[model samples]
Structure formats: structure tokens, C-alpha cells
Target: MAVAPSFKLPNVGPGPDPLSLSALAADNEFVLLLLQRDYHCGNCRKQVQVFADWYDEFHERNTEVVSIVPEPRERVRSWQEEYDLPYPLCADPEAAAGEEYDQPVRFGPLGRFSDLLGRMPKAVLLDCRDGDPTICYTHEGSSTWDRPELEEVFDAIDEQR
Candidate 1:
């Protein structure tokens, strides 16, 4: 299942306000993965690297894959540089996008019992064609690194083309 929500946030590198999702969709089909800062887990870094690898291959086919991290611009840039990610890594510090996707930003063990209920890692794929965008897939929780399912997501995107 995919989540397609309307947003009017600032764009990267000074372009326009209320960025048009329709325009972006018309330009290219995209897969957006939302990530949170996990200071205690090295796996988050690896997860991003995996996405980067997929982005490289997908871009060649004219598919846009972007990862949005809920961090400040400087921090996001540092990670992008460190990982050598070739795609855009936008800053979504407030996790507004994540909430829009209906991911379990909250309701986890730590989140349910504490005040940190609104910070969780999740992924959402968007198939932006001539019409309104549609969500192609979604994954939330800890076992995001699991295979087969991940491969299935790529396959689904490929099938759309």
C-alpha cells in the first residue's frame, strides 16, 4: 500500500515555496523513504547505504529515489556526503511527511511508554504518473533490513514501468 499526501514545504537550494508534488511526479516516478536519527544503531547507516545503492541503479532507468531524514540541513548534508549518496536527501526535522504517510511514527515500545512516540523509521514508495500519485509500498518497524520483501519492492517499481 502507498500513501499519497499533499504537502507545501520549502524546497532545497532555493527554488520555490509550496513545492508541487504533481510537478515532481510528472518529471519522474519516485520512491521516498523516511528515516529517523538512530544514534544507537549503526544499522540505520547501512540502511541508507542500501537505499543509495538502489538509487544509483534506479536512476539509470529514470526512476527517482529520494530519502528524507528528520534532521537539520547540516546534519543531513553531512550524512549524505559521508554516504556518498547521489540523490537528494531532504531535511524533515518535524517528521511531517512521516505522519502524512500514516507510518507508526509512534506506538512502539519506547514510544508508547514515553514522550518519543512520534519518531520512527519508515519507507513509502510513490508511483508518480500523469495522474495523481499513488503509494506503491510501505514498511515500518525494526526489521527493515530484511530481504525478499525489499526485493519485492524493487520488483513492484520495475513492474510499474
Candidate 2:
């Protein structure tokens, strides 16, 4: 397994103030990072809501769900206002954090110029029980709608345990 990329971002949260990957790893057995396409993506919005709805179950499993949107803090705050996610929601305006995890970018120059046009979705489940976070499961979406079912993630967690 690969070591999960570390990120320190401003959390528009119902959780931590400043979400630090290392700190999250220290606190939870698993950290599920949802790298979103952009703020406007419908699928991304729905996926986050699902995660939020299932937050209790994830918490019971010693997991923390962190959603990373490649947009400015202000844009990310809007998401918090709309959805009131029960987990950490962070902003990565520069896409620096997303790039670290190799979040997909297609459509050539268009994708680079506009995340909404090119960036796909990604779900990374990190095993953080150890000092360093290790990526135990990952689903790199080929299309905007592509995403792993929550059961797949739960099974991965169970296997890791």
C-alpha cells in the first residue's frame, strides 16, 4: 500500500477547525478522504450527503470522513451551509492537495483551466492506526458519476482490521 498524501487545510467544519491529515490519523483508525470534482458537481454533492447520513456508522467503526473540494474557502463554506456535513469539509483552491493524491484531470488544457470541466472524483480510504497513514483502499473514478459503494469501503476497513 502507498502512504497517503498529507494535507493541512482550512476546515469548514462541524469537526476540526484546521483539518490536518496527520492529526486526523492520530485520532482515528481510518480516515476516508473524498476528493471531489468541484463545488458544482451534482454527484459530488449527493455523495457527500450520503456520507453525512452514514457518518454515525463510520464513527462507530472508528473512521473519519473528510471531504476535500478543490475550490476556495468561501466556496467550500457554501457547501457547509447547504449540507451541514457531520465531518470535515476542507478547501483546496490551488488543487495542491488534490494533486498530491493524484486526483484525475482530463480534457487537456480545459481541465487545468477549469476543474469543473475536467476533474473527476476520487475516494481514498487510509489506514491510520499506525503513525503514518497508509492507503488501504482507493476508487479513482473514470467518469463524474463513478464512485465506490459504501459497502466496498466498509469491507476494506473490516479486512484491514
Candidate 3:
């Protein structure tokens, strides 16, 4: 049994407060969390837009895509408005969830070697079973948009259907 890393942080959304990973996975919904280090970076902004487009395609399959950033609520709101992101954009300034998934919480032009590098930019696929969760797939890379494994993951998800 692979246990998910323990992560406890304050939730910064409108509806629910203090959201848990287990709680997020209970509905058999596939969670695609796009981790970002900074909210002002152009690259990060572009990545969010790409994810928004992908989420449109993924919604038909009952999947939920979320973009997680280590920024304050105010900035997050601005970002949502600026990009017009279709999905939920949440904040994790303490990086509680990012730590659990070992996701990179920082970004820079230096690539992965960036001083702010915390967790790798990765996509995690989770399947809910009886309120618990199992990791179906994971893709980590310097850039989330250009990962080659994404296609394989899509194929695997399709196969399972």
C-alpha cells in the first residue's frame, strides 16, 4: 500500500474550508492538479491556460482539473480573472499539498535548477475506491505542457474505460 504523504494546510476557497486530498478524491473524479510556484510568471500563466483547454476536453469524461498555486487568495482571484480559467484556482502558500505530492513549488528560467525549485511539475491521476484513493499515473518534468508521458496517460485512462 502506497501511502500519500501527509499534508495539512489551510484551504483558501469560497465554499469548503480546509479541503483534504481524501475528500477531494471521494467522488471517483480524476483530479488533475497543476502546481505552480509563482502567479506572475508568463510561463505559469500559459500553462494554466493550456490546462483550462485540456479540462474542457476532460470534463466530458467526468474529470476535474484544478490549478494549485503558492500565492495569496487575492492574487489567485486576479489570476482567475485575468486568464479566465474555467476550473477552480486555489492557493497553497504554505505548499502543504505540493509537499505531499513532492511537486515543485517554484519556477525560473534556469529550469529545474531554479533556486525556488521545490517540487517537480507533475500530473497525478488518482482513482477513488470506497472513499480511499489509488494513484493511477504520474508525470513529472521540467515543463508540464510538453511532457511526452501525457499521451500515454490519456491512452491508459481510455483503456480503463
Best-fitting candidate, scored by TM-score? 2
Between 2 and 3, whose lDDT is larger?
2
Candidate 2: tens digits of C-alpha lDDT, residues 12-123 = 9866778899889989999999999999999999999999999998999999999999999999999999999999999988988889998888999988899988999999
Ranking by lDDT: 2, 3, 1
Residue pair clashes in candidate 2: none
* Pairs in steric clash, model 1: 2-135
TM-score: model 1 vs. ground truth: 0.73
Runs of candidate 2 exceeding 4 Å displacement: none
When 1 and 2 are scored with lDDT, the better candidate is 2
Let me know the TM-score candidate 3 reaches against the reference structure.
0.72
The true-versus-predicted C-alpha distance at residue 139 of model 1, in Å, is 1.8
Listed in order, each prediction's TM-score against the native is: 0.73, 0.97, 0.72
Better of 1 and 3 by lDDT: 3
lDDT of 1 by residue, 1-161 (tens): 44488664433422233345565677776645544443223555677677667765677556665565655566666776677766556666665666676655455677534324445566676777745788876667644343224576677678777
Question: Against the unseen true structure, what C-alpha lDDT does each candidate score?
Answer: 0.59, 0.92, 0.60
Best lDDT among the predictions, by candidate number: 2
